[model samples]
Every structure is written in structure tokens, then in C-alpha cells.
Target: MENFTPSISVSSQVTHSLLARLLALAYVDQEVDLREVELIYGIALERGVSKETLESIMLRPHSVSTILPSTPHERVSHLYDLARLILADGIIKEEERAMLRRSVLLYEFTEENADGIVDFLLEQAQAGVAPAQVIQVVQESI
Candidate 1:
């Protein structure tokens, strides 16, 4: 897969929502791992989100609206990022998998494709594929 740079600009709501979801996933095991925090922080930084804003969301994820991105690329990008966060701690908890499945529906992927997409994303993340490459592969298949 070639390099992919998502050109879409998402609202602050979307970014916060994604971060909030990441936070939720990180705590699925009942403890927040350092790796998970680092991954989420890195993602936030890459998207130009402020540390203060991320800290605020960390303090209160409920304040962030669950706004999904409008475009397929943006949706897949967010999903891939979530997949990466799931694999950050080198463990795949049942709760984390459940969250990814729920996210597929929230992202508007058809039910028929949701399981396969989630499986593929997890496989790619486990194999250590870059998020951009994983997003590109999924987009091409779509």
C-alpha cells in the first residue's frame, strides 16, 4: 500500500469524540495502560489537538459528543486509529473488540461488511502495518 495522507478536515467535535472513544477503549481492561495513553496522545497531537483539550477530554469524556466523520476515508481512518490503540498494549480484550464492532456500525459501514472490516483492521494492526497503509488498503477494497 502506498502512503496515504487524509486531507479531510474534521470538526473539534469529531476529534474529541474519537479521543473519547480511545479513552473508553483504553480503560476496557479496567486499567489504563501507558501505551494506550501514549498512542491516543500521539494521535491527538497529529490532528493538531491541544494537550489541554485532550487533558480536558480525559477528565470528562462525557462532555464530548459522539460525532462520526462524514466521509468514508475519514471514517476508515478513525477506525484504523482505534484499531492501533487496541493493539498498543499487546492485548486484545473482549471489550475492546466489542467497541470496535460498535464503532463499525456507528461509522455507517454495512452490517455485511462490519465483521470482515473489523477483523481485517485488527489483523493489520497486529501485523504492525502503518495506519495510513491500513486505511489505504481498506479504501481500495471499498
Candidate 2:
């Protein structure tokens, strides 16, 4: 892991994370589109998440391994951003919910704290909160 060097950009990492969450949400209700795959791949390339990693994330139908926290604010903000994007279509897909649950695991959040995170995400998703506001909330909480 120490030797692993991602070739993708910082912006792309953020983008890829959001895209992954969205795809997972889309997957909940139905099959994913080719365009979605292409979009994810493109973002993955830019974000440095290998094609294999992207595939694993896309293929994950349920919870994934614990996410070693990089930064509390970043992890929470990503979750918020994803939740917002998932609800942007005005319906919460099962795939998205599953992905969010899996994401919580991947983000390595504490079991007790995960519920709060989920609550915050659901609230933001339902309320149509702005991404900026979501970030602000995550930042303040962190």
C-alpha cells in the first residue's frame, strides 16, 4: 500500500467518490447503463482509482470492508455529497442506500457514529440541502 501511487488528480478523487456513490444508488433499482460505466471509468482514470478498484466498487452489491479514515471531515463530506447526488433525482434507490451503507463501512466510521452519519445524510438528501451547506455541516461536526 505504501508503494501504491495513484496517477489521478485530487479533484478527480472527489469526483470519483461522488460518481461511485451515485452509481451504487443507480444500481439499487435497476441495471447500470453503459454510459454510467463509461462515466465511472473516465472519472476513475482521472482519480487514480484503478480500473480494478472501480470494478470492485461498482460490483459491490452490499457492504464493503472498513474504510480507514483519511480525515473525519473529508469522509463525512463525501458521504453528504453522495447522499445529495443520490436524491437529486427525487427518489432514493435501493442501490444507493446499500452503497451508502457500504460506504459507511468503507469510511471506517465508528459503529455508534454511523447512525448519526446516516441520519445526517438522509436529512440532507430529503431536504435538498446545498452541497455547500452539507460541507459546512460536515466541517462543523468534524
Candidate 3:
């Protein structure tokens, strides 16, 4: 094992973590739609995550830790992505909403503000507001 080293990079790890959570959110409704899978795969690919790594995480999401980005902007951008994924299939189940609440907490938002944040993000996502624009709005408000 002297020469052995972990192949996954820090960036890849973050990608894995994010994809895992997205996958979990997609599965919350007991049905993983093709749209959801496509969205997740698209994100993984954009982040330069290998197909093998993506598949591994997809097969075992629980193995990956829930590690959000360090910066507040990155975290909120991720939250927006999660909200976007929740609306991908054109239906938002109560289960999805609950999962998003838990995700908001994981993203380091206060419990008191989780609902409002989630609602706002969901509304923005539904309105087709771009992620960058949302990030700008959030950062300005802070």
C-alpha cells in the first residue's frame, strides 16, 4: 500500500457530495425521474467528475459525506441547484419540501430561516431566475 493514493480530488469530493445529496433528494418522492438523473449527471460532468466516480456515488450515495462549499455564495448557489432539481419534474411533493428543509440546514442556514429560504429559493427556481442572479440577490441582501 506504499504507492496507494486516493484518486478522488478535493473538487471531485465536493462534486460527489453534492451529487449524492441531489440523488437523495430525487429519491425522496420514491421515484427517480429521468430528468432528475440527467440533471445530476450534467452537474457531475460539468464539475469534471469521472463517469466511474459518478456511477460509484450514484450506487452508494450514503458513502459520501455531506460537504457543502466553504464560501457562502457557493453554498447558496448549491442550494439554488438543489431547488432547481426539486422542480425539474414539474411536481413538488411534500417529501421533496421536507428534504429541501433538511438540506437548507445542512447548508448552514439557521433553523428559523430555513423555511423562508427554502420558499424563496423554490419560488425563484420556479420563476426561472438564473442561479447567478439569485446568488447576486442573496449576496446583496446579506
Candidate 4:
């Protein structure tokens, strides 16, 4: 085992971690739409996650090994992506809010900041703010 190198790369794992977490959020409402699936796949490809890895993770997101980014900024980016997912169906489900709230702590945000940002993001989404713009505001505001 001294020279063993896993076939999956570190970047792939990181993308998988992000994808898996987002997949979990996607499922909390017990419905997955084509648009949401397409967006997740597109984002995963952009992040260097192999199609095979993404497919496997989608098959069993809860079992995925999560390796969340270390920096607060990176973690916050993941939160933004998740918040964008909430807007995928054009209607934010209550289950999505609950999952996002749970994720705030999972990503290590302080309760106060997490609560504030999630609320702000939802309002932004409702107000038709683009995800990128919301991300910018969140990154700056938090």
C-alpha cells in the first residue's frame, strides 16, 4: 500500500463533497425536477467531478464522503450554490429552508450569521436577484 494512489483525484473528491451535500438538500423535499438535476450536473462538471463520480453520488448522496472546503469563503460559496438550488423549481419548499438551516451549522457558520444570511438569500431569491448577484451580496454582507 506504500505507493497506492486512488483513481479519484482530490479535486474530484472536493466536487463530490459539494455535489453530495447539494444533492441532500435537493432531496429534502422528496422531489427532484429535471432543471435541478441538469443544474447540478452542469455545476459538478464545471468543478471537475467526473460524470461517473457524480452519478454514483446522485445514486446515494447520503453515503457520500464529504470533504467541505476549509476556508470560510469557500464554505460560504457552497452555501450560495445551495441557496441557488432552492430557487431551481421556482418555488422554495419549506423542506429546503429546513435543510439549508441544518447546513449552516454543518458548514461551520455561527448561528447568528447563518440565520441572517439564509434569510437574506431567500429574500433576494424572492426578489428575483440573480444567484451570482446574491452570492456577491452574501459574500460581502457576511
Best by lDDT: 1
The numbered model that scores best in TM-score is 3
Model 1 regions lying over 4 Å from their true place: 1-10
lDDT score of model 2?
0.64
lDDT tens digits, residues 39-127, model 4?
A: 78877876777688788887887777878787766777677778778887888888898888888888887888777878866777667
Give one digit per residue, the lDDT tens place, for model 2 in 92-119.
6666776777778777888777767777
TM-score of each candidate structure, all chains considered together:
0.89, 0.59, 0.91, 0.81
TM-score between candidate 3 and the true structure: 0.91
lDDT of 3 at 129: 92
Candidate 1 local distance difference test against the native: 0.88
TM-score, predicted candidate 2 vs. hidden true structure: 0.59
Residues 1-142 of candidate 3 have per-residue lDDT tens digits of: 4897867677667777888888889889889899998988877776677788889988888799977788888889888889989989987789999989988998899999999999999999899898889999999999
- What would the per-residue lDDT of candidate 1 be over residues 8-110, giving only the tens digit for each residue? 3558778888999989888888998989999999999988899998999999988777888888998888998899999998888898998999999989989
lDDT of each: 0.88, 0.64, 0.86, 0.77
**Candidate 4 TM-score, C-alpha based:** 0.81
Model 3 clashes, total count: 0
Instruction: Give the Cα error of residue 79 in candidate 3, in Å.
Output: 1.0
Deviating ranges (above 4 Å) for candidate 4: 1-7, 125-142
